[model samples]
Target: MKKLKLIAVLVLFPLGLNLVGVWELQRSTDDHAEYAAYQADLAEFRPELQAIADNSGSRPVMVDVGDGEKMEVKMALSRVTEMQDELDTLLPLTNVMAWVAKGTITLGLLAALVGGLGLLALNWAGRRAMHSRDQLLHSFTRVTKLLPYVLVGHVVVMGAAIAAIVAFEALGAWHAGRLSAGEMKFMFFGMVLVAGCLYSIWQMGTQLRVMLNMFQPTPMDVMGEAVTVEQAPVLWAYVKDLALTLGALPPDHIVLGMAAGFYVTSGDIALAPANTTLTGRTLHVPLAYLGILDEAETTAVIGHELGHFAGADTEFSMRFVPIYHGIERSLVVIGQTLVDSEWLQRATLHPAFMLGAYFMESFDHAVMHWSRVRELEADAAGAQLAGNLAAASALVRISAIDPMLQERLVAHITQATRPTSEHVPVSDLPTTVLREIAALPLTLPEEEMATQLPHPSDTHPSNGERVASLKVSIDDAVRSGTRPLDATQACAAMDRYFAQPDVLRARLTDDYLSHHVQQDAVLVETLRTHAGNVTGDVALHEGARLRGQILIGFSGLLAVAGLILLLAPVLFPGAAGRDPQPFFVGAGIALFIMLCMLPFGVRLFRRAHKTALLLTPDHFVFANLKAPLPIRDIADFNLQVGNVVMLTILLEDNAPLPELTSRSFFAPDVALNKKKRWLMLPMSKFCRDDKKLKLPELAELIGNYVNAGAARHLLQQRSEQSGELKAG
Candidate 1:
């Protein structure tokens, strides 16, 4: 449907140009008074020429003329005859040119009208089809399916129209005895237009075929290694049983990927109920996702993928995929063609191109909006299959885990590579890490969740929106009686039945490290040395101190200026009577603002002065801590790198601390509780320009004091890995 609309625009664009040409031609040819006056002059001279010719009497006769003594009558008659012939010949051609101009304008108007009506009808039909929902899948199927036909029709009609216009102009040039330079240019432009339209149509067809091929179900040949029933019988059994319970056909092939998601693929044609089977279906399950998800959650995730098939989403997508991709490819082709042509490049800044671009953008947005609706429908189906609560929980967990899992994997690899670790075999690493991550809270904050809202181009709704919709489904009586095996037991069963676990684990680890890790043996050694020398309080970096001083100076300057302003009226007594109130009011506001901000300014100054890493014999002090933290109580310390460096301290169990009030006078009423917490340190404030400390160095230093054996071993392993990398 969008393709047809674009084709209409293309046709109408040239039609408009041609109409303008015709109008200009008509204006130039409209005045025939000059030709009529020339005819009248010729008519007046003809009689005199006839009399002169008759009087010549077959000889060059001398005759008495008014202005001269003698003249040849034959020569005078010849001049009059030439003037009459020229007028007679030129006048008819002028009339013919005017008529042809009017005819071309008429043809252009007719084509525009027809094309506009066709496009309007197609758009109206599309809207009607979208609104009609009595037949579920059948409602919009016919309308959507008609889109390709309309596109083909549009191509044919527009191509023919362009060819006709070019032919008419060429024929007119031939009839006029020669083609003007401007006419030749117009013909060349017409040819280029035809060629571009043809190329775009061909490209759209190719893209559509490729997009449709994605829906053709087959075995998982190009995906990850296959997980047969023999290798994961229990896992397979749960998935198969869930499929049957949800009224969906079980997948014949299951493939495990390294990424964190699952999806289903099926053939384009829907099979009859009697012949329906899973022979042509493939289910792709990412091992990372499976490892982290509990049995129920896993069921929910798989159910969501299966829902694509059970909910007729696969069929709907087949129709929508072509339209969406066709618009995208067409835009690319048009944009590229315009850029490649100098004339077209200039034309892009014209209002026509801007309007066209806006139209295409609006079409894309509409298609994506429908795509998001399809996603929600599929989610609802999955809710029915796996129970709404489970489905909602699965989505939320996936949203959080998708980003966190990679970091966790990197941390685990760092820990497992340590020399002091009882090297758990690679086969055991995935399960161990999964269990550890599962134990941590996986809630995403509301602000972070808001970022997931669907953009104009996105096909999926936000996680929060999906969860809300699932909750509605749950409240509306969507539930399941069947419960899967316990999470721990299910994981154990999967591990026991799985084949080549070590190879898979190593593959995932290597893939991650290759992309993310950059080995630096020298940097590792430097960090190790820094860890050994951290025995005293470290001051803020010189850069941080300079920044702090600048801020303090600005604040002090403002304060001084406010005081001066407050005393300005008294000092300048000549102006006191006229504007004393205004001066006092303005000065008072400035002073009040400065005074209000004084506490914050004092806090910033204190942080600049007192912020440090205090490493004592028995404790580690960070940032603005009232006292040092006992080294023995620290469980782990990690670093997060961004605009500024942050060191997070995780305490063991639930350690207690003394009650404290806010350090800043502005917030004196705020209080702190005595409990183990994740404390963050702004390490950038304590860094120095001459000897800048990296996050890894800081983390290593703190880790050494917190867990000496683990820190030493981890650093040693890091050194070894770095050396190996450098050697290779």
Candidate 2:
């Protein structure tokens, strides 16, 4: 309890109390006049600027009158003041004198802080207990085998450091015959603490290194026989190519699973790394009951998995895997890297550090969800290398093939998300979700949402979006009459992403389903809620731009006020009581008013979300932004790529034009609402437009693209796999 109290004072209370104080302070000092001026100027319109907004998306507008009603400004100011207070309440105080006072309060607030810290630790341990992190642990343990070498290095370095420190201390005390006992005690204690920390780190590193497969060179194909396994002749051909790719991977290991097989640990390998192991791969094929995918499809799967291996993507992750694995293994086996990183050396150190480390580890788990998403990219790269036809089939087959594993995966997914709900009362969750949970769901947004950031903002494209991107890339290459480049080479090159093919099919059906085709109801609802917003925001943003013109016009009022102020001194010289302060104040107000008229800036988060949604209009006519994409711009296309389908509407008369992404593919009806605002389109309205594009016209357009030999070739293998009659 004392340790908990100390932690609360040092960490939790300071973050909380300081933020609350900041918010309260800001609340006390918000300015209202600025807001009213902003609003009133927005609603009022000018004829010259209004036309530009209507025709060109938005117009450069300015208000001629510097005089806005004072009452409106006052009310606006009042609201902003409250908002400021809310903001202040959330701040982590960095103001002068806060450090000492905050530090003092922190020492006392440790109990409250430690409570949440303890809660987080309990939740993390519970989660680890419940999940099959053992598979991951085993995988990491393989990495830990290398830890002994690392431990040796650390021990050598720290031993030398200790000896040097001791020697220096002895030299200083040589003249005194003997060191003061108290002074000697403090020095010994400090050195011992440092030594213990070094030992712990070395021990942990050694444990995790045991799990690492990369530290040792073990070929996946020990005998170097690529044709050892028997299969269909067509499948064999692609497998041969796959073997070559795998052979090139250092520490050569080749694994194949048509569905989900234990081949990773199966063929002459008792302890291959999880990366080399082939359990999950065969599960998809077998569980879905898919007849083996065709040559192209199979090739795609191999290429995709192979891409992950070749690129050393797994190595890229697990940078910290060894550290944690070492600690966990040591904790489980010997019970020592169990000491907290900061407090491990101090015999009297706070237990909260260990608890705090628990949350940090939990947070790492939360972020690891992105690794699954990253797998999707590997999937796409595999498709690209193996050929689109094979990849497309492979993806379709994957969803169908791995039922039990997918179910388990879905369960693990639920486990991962539980941390986000850590704060939710267990009583509130559905009985099923509650039962699966080990502890209360973590309610902290900062940790859960933190991982989501630096994702879309990063140069690495999202895994969810990669399939679409690859499709566009393929279409572009085909149109350009260039042979598709190698996936490895393509990664090293750059090009404007080409147009996407119109979707031929997108529906959900399974063992429990009654319908042949079903739209995602969630998507429909989402589209319904936000399609209106995308439109309204686009319109509102434009309106805001036009209204801001009025703000600029206030500058003219500033000029007039300045003129009035200067002229009043001479023109009203006889009026002894005339004050120039009023004119000058008016001019200042006009200048301030002008500044507010500029375009209302969109928040970065909102923009990022918009980018994620792919919401920017295909062609936008907004203030200072003009982008037009006509339906004639589409070329030979395919909208039937795995799990995605859409209508393609071209806007240009020219053949084989660069694509317009947002406009061409009509949102699949079911998904229209769920992702409507994200796509930033009134998709249904555009898709349903009778005058502009009736169903027959859309159909004819699709038929024309499908009929083209270039597009037809892509489906030659796909249509046959689906047993669907190929339309001429």
Candidate 3:
């Protein structure tokens, strides 16, 4: 709803510009009594000059005696002629200004009308298209293709408006007969707007290139080892039969990984760990879950994945995936790069780009709606392949069991990697997991069973929703466990399919654990180094101070520029000509802007002075802390890098903690949790010679003090894994 309101504002921005143009037109074209008198005198004096020129002898030429006073004909004629010359010069400039204003109003009206109506129609079409699969696919494809054109149109409209503004200023200076400081400043401003528009376009092009690159095939090594038909003949045979039964094409390739759930993809798969690529229709089956889910449950899960390949879903994906990634990249670029640009802000191009961005963003709700519908459709297909109850049971179990499995795996990895504990091989992880799954309660809690499954490829329906859609009770699904794992192999799927199930499990588990341990080692080292008392000037806060100073300088420049514009007409009377209203108005606006910005700049500057962060074994201190905050109460910390580099510190507030405040004008305090307080630390460059607190060092220090540094290790593992999509 907030996004909709923002889009409306953007769409109406051009109309607002039109209103300004209208006001300017009226102001420029207003009747001046002095100029009118000059015109009247010129009319009366022209014939008198002609008569005087025609006379053979010296004659006392009587001028217009409207006030009953006769003047010297030659002298009156000279004054009237001078006024006529001035009028000839000023009238053309005034006409040009009027024409420019009209043009601006016309263009602004068209842009506002077309942008608003077009987005509304598109939004309506998008909502209507959700009823049919083909329509849904077409709607998304059409919008994706139209996005580039919409952005281009935005640029063109903004460019034209800027051109109009520049033309008006240039012509105004030309009529003035000399360049004034005000004219030069406005011209410079117009140039900056053009530069910002061009830069923003270049950035969009760069992001588009990134989107195109995503289409190329990337490796699946990080996801898992590929399984050929020869290696898993039974599994291959089962999948082919399942695909045929579900009226879908079988996967071109199969990958076995230790991820939580199953998923299918037709796009290029990139492997994060190995930085490699794979191309083809791929089906990824979770190795850990294979031992946990029985035959019927496995059949239902596999059916659900294959259901995506049914009804031309994968075929649509071939077109949709690249566009989806492109939109994501574009939004990221707009938010992170273009949105923060000072040039764009000054030129007001930021609002234009945001308009385009939000138009694209508005489609997300529709996309999510249709995405959920697609999932539900696939769920129905899965139900058709297996019994509805069986499919429901599989969905419920997958959602419930995965978190439990992750907890066990993370716990084991955390303990095994500890400095005090002996190295423990994870070769028997499959057998251990199988035992744990068998030991799970016959019925899971409603909260756990009602949650959505963990799938990386798309948003999923909740377990209860899927079960209800399948016309089955949640309790029935929970109680309907799959048959036990084979006694010897400890996994039904492994027993039925692989010739060497134990060996494969051992290799995969060892590889997964080794990768995690290697990543954790670096974080563990950092934690150990920063586990003692430390004091240093926060680079984040220092960066904020520098930004504040820059802002102050910018505001000062604006104020100075405004003063110059306000005084330009007086200092250079000839350069201002007959009117000085434009200069005064421009000066007023600039001064107002300066006034508004100065306070924020000063606040940021003052608050960031001597800002230091102190970390100790027990607590940490930041800004003007009334008391040091307990390190043990530190819940988590996240470092965000972009236009503003910031570190967020979350502290548990259940117990009495220090009254902490940032007093930052830009990034204020945000409430993240009911019983927790959030502290924002703005950061930038750090001293690398172990002198100042680094962002990563700060996170590590907090992680070390919290939960015996186990979360620190877990955080590293999770960060890498979540950074890119895995098999799940």
How well does each candidate superpose onto the true structure, as a TM-score?
0.47, 0.24, 0.66
Q: Give the alpha carbon lDDT tens digit for every residue of 1-728 in model 2.
A: 64466445435544554454344334322322333344344444233334443564333333333476233333343444544443243222222123323333332244344444445444544455334434444433343353334323323333333333333333222221245777777666666765664576455454444323223322222111121223223333444567466542322333222113211111122211122332111201121111223345545655654554444454433233334433443333222323433343322122323433443354355336444544566566666666654554344333322343345334433332222323321221112222232122212221221122121111233322443545634333222222222322221121111111011000011111211012234433444443223221121111122233444455566657656665675778765255666656765676565445322222211221122111222222212212332212333332332322243333223433332334322111112222221112222212221133444554454343223322333334433533432221
lDDT of 1 by residue, 1-728 (tens): 64555554645664874575475455436434566786787577667767877876788776554486666777656655665665465566566556545555654555565556545554554454444222323533443355334434444444444444444343333222345788777767766765765565455454444232222222212324456787667668878887877767677777665543576654321222112333456676767566555666677777766665564565554444433444444445555655665553333222223323443453444555666676787777777766777777666656666665667666655544432334343444456556666566555554544445312223677766777777644222212212222347535644643566666566545543433323434445655664565455443331344554655676677778877777888898776767688777777777777776665555545555443565553576543456667765677777787865666667667565523323543221212323546665543433533355666665555555655433444566667874654454
Evaluate model 3: give its lDDT.
Answer: 0.65
Write model 3 residue lDDT over 416-514, tens digit each, in one string: 554232344557676666666567653467687557777665767676777788898766777774334343444655556877777777777776777
Q: For every candidate structure, what is the RMSD over all alpha carbons to the true structure, in angstroms? A: 18.8, 30.0, 12.6
Clash number for each model: 2, 88, 6
Better candidate number, 1 or 2, judged by TM-score: 1
The candidate scoring highest on TM-score is 3
Give Cα-based local distance difference scores for all models.
Answer: 0.54, 0.35, 0.65
Lowest-scoring 10 consecutive residues by lDDT in candidate 2?
A: 500-509
Better of 1 and 2 by lDDT: 1
Candidate 3 colliding pairs: 218-277, 218-278, 219-276, 219-277, 540-682, 540-683
Ranking by lDDT: 3, 1, 2
For candidate 1, what's the RMSD? 18.8
